[model samples]
Target: MDTQPNIRSYVIDLADQLGIRYQATPEDALADIATRLAGDEVVIDEIEDLLVALKRTGAINGNEMVTLLGQYLDEKFSER
Candidate 1:
């Protein structure tokens, strides 16, 4: 399925706020974050972007957000 661009943009834009935290390039950062992806890891920035975006948005709390994202990515990879 084609993912949403706004979500993806939100991710990278969010990553920018993370600055040093996201030391790698956007693509690399996504790849690393998405390594939960099996066998052939994907470079899907959309997913990574979402992670960063969620963190960037002050709408949520920190520990809860991490827990939520960790569960999410695990589920996504588990599906593969």
Candidate 2:
């Protein structure tokens, strides 16, 4: 039995059905944000807020947004 989650297929199909074209993955998005945050201290809340703003403004699609948010939260909690 395959234990790994089969997550991406349904999302891809849903996006295709909805006619949504995604431009970047979560890692690409974090890289962009990391570039933007260069020369500054890393503040988890601030980064989260920035990502939330981007999502609110429709800058990133839902799947990538959640992925980015999950990565951010994982990093934030793991550091402690």
Candidate 3:
């Protein structure tokens, strides 16, 4: 079973590819997601929409996008 931070590897890698600087720490990626999801509640549809947008824009591949979505859901639901 993969941990939540580990599951965000693709996103952090993508950020690195884009030359975006973030904290050199384990929680940075999760923090990034929280920052993005801040103004509103994050729901499954939003996650799906994000996945579609990322895939449509060639930002993330299919399998990994699914994995990311699953991980995101796990993190979200696990917090409840």
Candidate 4:
């Protein structure tokens, strides 16, 4: 599980790698989708692109990413 700060920081770092300026808050990052993704509103394509880059670079796998995100989300909502 990732803490709010961790998730926020990680996403920001990913954005940096993708050459995208993600100056949003952690909550914003949670809601924001792939910037380069197609579709009218969903940025899933962007996410896929990022995933590919991460995979190629051996940065992080999709499973690890999901686990961290899930942990973060659980911790966040648990507080509510």
Candidate 5:
């Protein structure tokens, strides 16, 4: 049983829960989540956990994770 599709679906579902309205792929959802997280005053644990899980599952690579985190931090700190 291939779990890739299932994992992708789960990512989309999590994105929805995070308030992303339209995401065609896991990467898209991840980017949107990162953007939203950048604007948040406090990091949401569930979303952070989801990102870690995605990384563990190979949905995102280390470089991608670093890029997203960098973007989030840049935006977040620039506001301070």
Candidate 6:
């Protein structure tokens, strides 16, 4: 069975636990979280490393990586 949706849900839940307010789109919420967590110099590599660590620790699943990280990247790039 396809588990992408489930992974995405889990990732969203994880985001909430991380204090990300879902007051807008997922991408917007991610951007807000990034700003609050990393400030202005939001390094892409550091974000990737953090996500990887989260997955390794089972805080997030492998499948949700693309869903969560990709949305953040999309939001960041759109501003460029």
Q: What are the per-model C-alpha RMSD values against the true structure?
A: 8.6, 9.1, 10.2, 9.6, 14.0, 10.5
Model 2 lDDT, residue 12, Cα: 41
Worst 10 residues of 5 by lDDT: 3-12
Model 2, C-alpha of 47: deviation from truth (Å): 1.4
Cα-based lDDT for every prediction: 0.55, 0.58, 0.59, 0.54, 0.57, 0.60
| Cα lDDT tens digits for candidate 2, 1-80 | 96743334433444455555534568757876887778655544545555554565576667877996786676567769
TM values, all candidates? 0.39, 0.42, 0.44, 0.34, 0.39, 0.43
Q: Candidate 3, residues 1-80: lDDT per residue as tens digits? A: 75545434555555557554432344645765886778654434444454555665667789878888888678667879
Residue range 1-80, candidate 4, lDDT tens digits: 84457554565577576665323356545556443243346434334444445554557677866775566566556779
Model 2: runs farther than 4 Å from truth?
1-44
Candidate 1, residues 1-80, lDDT tens digits: the string is 75654433544555556551323457865666667664565554455545655555554468856765676566567769
Give the Cα-based TM-score of candidate 2 against the true structure: 0.42
Estimate, for each residue in 1-80, the C-alpha lDDT of model 5 and write its tens digit. Answer: 75454433455575556554431468857876888888954444444455565566666788876665565555456769
Off by over 4 Å in 3: 1-43
In model 6, where is the ten-residue run with the lowest total lDDT?
19-28
TM-score-wise, the better of 1 and 3 is 3
- Count clashing residue pairs per candidate: 1, 0, 0, 1, 0, 0
Tell me, by TM-score, which candidate is best: 3
lDDT of 6 by residue, 1-80 (tens): 85454433555556557754323346745886889787675544545555655666667686777676887576557769
Tell how far residue 16 is off in model 6, in angstroms: 12
lDDT of 3: 0.59
